[model samples]
Target chain A: MTTSTPLQPVVQARGLVKRYGRVTALDHADFDLMPGEILAVIGDNGAGKTTLIKALTGAITPDQGEIRLDGKPVRFTSPMQAREAGIETVYQNLALSPALSIADNMFLGREIEKTGVLGSLFRMLDRAQMRKEARAALTRLGLMTIQNIDQPVETLSGGQRQGVAIARAATFGRHVVIMDEPTAALGVKESRRVLDLILDVKKSGLPVVLISHNMPHVFEIADRIHIHRLGRRHAVVRPSDVTMSDAVAIMTGAMEPPAQAA
Target chain B: MSTDQPSSAPRGPQAFEKVLPENEAPVRFEAERESGIKRFQNLLHSHPTAIPGIVLVASLVFFSVMVGGRFLHPFNFSLIVQQVMIIGIVGIAQTLVVLTAGIDLSVGAIMVLSSMVMGRLAVEMGVPTPLAIAAGIGIAALCGFANGVLVTRFRLPPFIVTLGTWNIFFALNLWYSASETIRAQDIEASAPLLIFFGQAVELFGARLTYGSIAMLAMVAIAWYVLNRTAWGRHVHAVGDDIESARLAGIRTDRVLLMVYVVAGVICGIAAWALIGRIGSASPQAGQTANLDSITAVVIGGTSLFGGRGSIVGTLLGALIVGVFRNGLALSGVNVLWQEFAVGVLIIVAVAIDQWLRRTSR
Candidate 1:
């Protein structure tokens, strides 16, 4: 029943396992990310979605299994390691500093320095260059309405802030962008803008791994969907192959099918 | 992307938009409803974070008026300057520690210990005045270094570590002096040159004392270090968010140690000024400096939470308290009530600061 042929998977995980205290968050879960495609990971609360993502992103350690990035076997010891290997994860919290402006937050730890000892002596930041680059990123994301790039992020709306965060991940030039329920605390208009941003990101030839519990959203944007049940990825189906009802049954662990499908 | 769909409302993850009404408010957007000038004013006025500075300035003005104009008289003004130099110097030292959201309760005790050591070495040990003075300050620096080590290496809370050092210095000071005052006679033979800080420098229609000039210079340097330097930025970052600073690869533990050590060195300078101005080094001298220095810091608009403060604001705060006491003393107010008056002023200053903060926000 699958219409389109499967694509090349950029990220492939095998036999990943993790246990926290008495609870087994992830057990032998395997997942895959196709090249230049959006893969949605959806499950109920505490269904090990975050755990799996964290393990993949090097935020947490896994007990077993191997993860392959671009067909290369690698283990990320820290978030920096993952980021260096071209993996960027935008958490639900976004990890943006409210006290600093958008441009400052974008280059928080890494700042562009001007040339010479005079620059070192004066400790002057290259405001002109940073502003120019930040403006370009904002324009690319259709967020030109934000006039002052120097104002604190606390002053921005939810959607605008999320847009800034997505812009940051994309600007960092990471090959894989993992968003952990990015639109969870955003409004309708803002969430839509974010989805558009996702499309724009995909157009840039980067693959996206979006984690969420929203089935309609998954069906709308995701090229392929992966559902995790009881510590294993139970299914990976393309949107065109199954109806919304079929996807829900797979998510809810109901084996029964509707008479129409037969 | 599917059709470049431009419906009135954008759609995405339904979990966010359909649920969680809290996220849909978009209150941040309304901040732009005000004009540019109004927003600038709002930013200044509502910065509750700057309340301590406001109270410091207002208290200075109120106290200046309360003393029947004697507060602003050239001679009385110079007196205020000379009187608060010790507190001002120590206040700057305390600022560094407090900026990291840590406190050094040993400031007063350290000042006393440093001065006692300087006096004894110059008097009893026959050391040259300069050498004796250096030794005194060196003693303070060492105390600070120990405090730093305890806090950073041992991972002790700054409060407990500094409090422990405070008692140790107090005991040392009392034991060294045997509860007696080290008189000017003994000090004169040793560090006579250091006594120049007690003298006054005459200017146009007024005079600025040596200690006051030194105090002002220290304030300027401290302000620059806290506001302009790369170290300053890192200090503020560590104070504001330790975890974020660590992730950014800042040596926060080293920075904390440096802050404490710098504070100790300032206390050494303060000891020299204190002994010069008072003409003696008694174990009991500078007993109230610790509390007074903290008061200045709190009144200077520095957040107790760290990551925000100004040395200029702190100097102004110090001057305010100094002028209030000088004015009250000149107006024939009972000397017994001076402490009470200062206490009342702190509460009033802090209250006004809080009001301004709440209203601005």
Candidate 2:
């Protein structure tokens, strides 16, 4: 499907099995992401798209699976651990504290401490340094229109908030960035900004996993399309190989998925 | 993309444009020039502490103009500090809890329990004075930590957890103290340290007790912790939006537990101040302390819903209550009228809070 496919996948998940009593969410899902590609995961409702992504991002642990990061087997128990391994997620709800300032929310849990007794003894934060770094991160993402680093997230528009959330993920996601419905709640113009941000992030050389319901957005941006069906990854296809109607048919079990590498 | 025509909005995800209701779309675009009042609202909303600060200064000015020199005198101000010391101390605890979007209805009960522990242990059991006090504070912390455990581990709502513990801690206090008061003289004879906070130094025309000074210091320290530290920011984050805080990788349960435990420690200290202020350890005292602290926190511009407030604003809130009581009494207003005034202030403060919150959309 591509002129030159890379030998190594940036993130690889194999034999991922998750269950909740009688219902199985992710059933033996296998996935792969080549370097510097926007991999869009798409499926009909209840087709285990969310479960597969959650299992990958440490939002949920699989009953059975092997996940590899940079060719080393790894298991994650929490989002924090996943982040520690250089995986960042931008949740659908834009997981930013509304009342906290932009810098505070950016460095919410991993706040920088001052160098001396003010930090060691009294636990004072280095607000100036944090603000400077936050400004730099935003600038790196071409989001410097936000004039105030101390402005609370509540004060920002929906597009600006999404910008902040994506900026956060892009700034920290060294290995891969996984986003769940990042544009699900935004307006048309705001969604445009987010799609541009996804491209901008990819340009910085990190792979992206976009979980999207919008077919148009998918066909426009995704380098590889991972079709999930019946609780597992059905096929990994390129947009150039099929029409949108055939993809929908495969997604809903109306047609057989084309044989391809996943 | 496909060589075919690009899918337009009508062909994109069906749910995308459905959520674009006109009424709620303004959050995406609110850049128009604001009216005069809108500008003022924006100013007040940005600085959560300014409303209470202005109210305090205005009230002081009003009371001084009405009650003349006596209301503004240094001695009168010191008396106000003394009057609010216990509530002020507990108010600090209440602020911590309220900032986390929780309330401790058991703060008064916890304070009494700790004081009664000190009183009963030192006087009846003949425990060492310092040891008894330590035991009391420790028990107080245990009670607070218990509340934390129940709230976090059990995943119970904080209001309900504290409501149940309020009664549990109150019953424990009655059982420990036998529903009796330790006479001031008996405590004086056995443990002078119990009343150490009651001792005062004369400054000009004022008598500032150690408890009052400690209350002030506690305000300063709490302010420093809340404003200058990462833990403090996490507290705001968890309160502002716990789910977001968790998603952001903060140990939210741990933060909440710390909040409850620290609140418990403050209650223990307030118990010490309670003994000094009342000159006796009485189980019947502080029946209204829990509500009173809530009053201070609310009036201080801290939201009951959590994630927005200031510690210094709470101290000012306590002073606001103290000033109203002293000034109204001095003006020959009946005790009933004083309470009436406080009730009005509470409603107004809550109304203002609701107003400020509604504008965020």
Candidate 3:
């Protein structure tokens, strides 16, 4: 949680602005993520937390802003471009084909083909290899509760589906992972599992940007908290430096941000 | 403020085991212990063709009992095969589109129009039979391409797009053919190759036409493509959730376009089969084929909702229709009643689909 060391920011945004008609969604917002740190972005409803995340993930473009990844300026016009730039996002909906098998869902857009002539000529998928790899990836994440890799995703519980989405992001994400409301719909036990998953992802040495509403969950996992208020970043504080009530009060405009942290 | 525990304090396998163990084993066993009807519904959801296979067998037995041994006669069985071949072939095209949660109401029109192209090219233009056939299939593919473009680029619903195209293709068929019917005698005498499928092969005391065999072959190929290839998986993925597929970086528009184009080519092949079955290329034939092919797809256990269906199930669906018609005919049932029976089958199929979907959720 120390800011004394000069570690480079993996992803940095400045002067990010977006507007819908007269109402501004984001106004000169600034963000920073240190290497391998879990940065939790939190705010009340319509505080433009989603807008800021969307801008960063290339879901939407900001009117005026500069985003730098690894100190190099970048502009992403679409989600695909962001993905190609090594940014993976797990959406709240999970973005999975429910009727397809778990293995198929895992390999989805980036499928592996057969090695030799079969792949080149016929474009046949190596089903066995994909299944094995999918199982391995889930097991590595300690998500082996799923007994059958061939079962359709709809048959799985909410937690398992969330796990699958995270596993997908973890497998392909090279630089950074972004999760939008990862445990919003889950019960107590499921939320715990997802929290554990977020920690596991951070341990893999990839920085995670988690957008969540739960203060306790954020307090439990996040290294640093990015407080968003009134369509802009209000404060950036370490979890150890702020209590849950203070964070909530700062977000709700009940108390001013501590001068030192600001 | 109390300091929060380190995020990595509860890491690795032991932590996951503590969180996921309570309900996993119970849920699996509960699924296994469900009632017979629930299990049956589960089967229908997972393997859509199971009910169709059972229905086919049950109908065969029912017809055998109603008509005695005559229903099982080789001649009668082959007759049923011939009756189902046109719809069955077209059903392959329908199944492809349907797998992506699409419908091509113009499939029958495309088939008839393509056959007309083959007939006019061979007879009036004096083109060789093979070349004429190729022209017919090529035009069909182009028509399909147009449909795909309209659906994808214009963002039109498949139902509306195909419905409009159906009328357009039918009108084109009539205009191009000038309401002229190619005579069977001329086709047989001048271009015997066109009528080649009419030739019969005897196997195990039953007569099977090449046209019927072609239908089976198309089914097998469709099965292989849908089940074995990356493109096939893409079709399923697109049908299941287009938004998810797009997010996953699949070019959903391209997959949908390919599906439409492939469906059109298959329809053209059906056109060739149509010429072989009837010994002539008539724009008037297969008038009810559009509905018939859809009927076959639904009965075969392909979900109208898309993303979950099999081509083999479509073949069985087509056969189910054929069996019902022939069996009713043998029992001296009215023709109108036969149509009524098919209507009932469609509703039941959809009902089964809904029931199975409920269990999956």
Best by DockQ: 2
Name the lDDT of candidate 2.
Answer: 0.89
Considering the two chains of model 1, state its CAPRI-style docking category: incorrect
Q: Candidate 3: where is the Cα deviation over 4 Å?
A: B1-33
Ordered from best to worst DockQ, the candidate numbers read: 2, 3, 1
RMSD of each: 5.9, 3.5, 3.2
All DockQ scores: 0.17, 0.51, 0.37
lDDT string, candidate 3, A1-262, tens digits: 4668998899999999999999999999999999998999999999999999999888899999899999999999888888889999999988899999999999888889999998998788899999999999899899998989999999898999999999999989989999999989997677888888898999999999999997777877888889999899999877767777788889999998888862
- How high a TM-score does candidate 2 get? 0.94
| Per-residue lDDT over B69-179 for candidate 3, one digit per residue giving the tens place of the 0 to 100 score | 889999889989999999999999999999898899999999999999999999878899999999999999999999999999999999999999999999999999999
**What do the candidate models score in CA lDDT, each in turn?**
0.76, 0.89, 0.90
Q: Stretches of candidate 2 above 4 Å error?
A: A1-6, B1-30
In model 3, the clashing pairs are none
Evaluation by DockQ, superior candidate among 1 and 2: 2
lDDT of 2 by residue, B1-361 (tens): 3434323322333355455566555754665657788888989999888988898898899899889998878899899999988889999999999999999999999999999999989988999989989988999999999999999999999999999999999999999899999999999999989999999999999999999999999999999898889999999989999999999999999999999999999999888888899889999899898899999999999999999998888888988998898889999889999899899989999999999999985
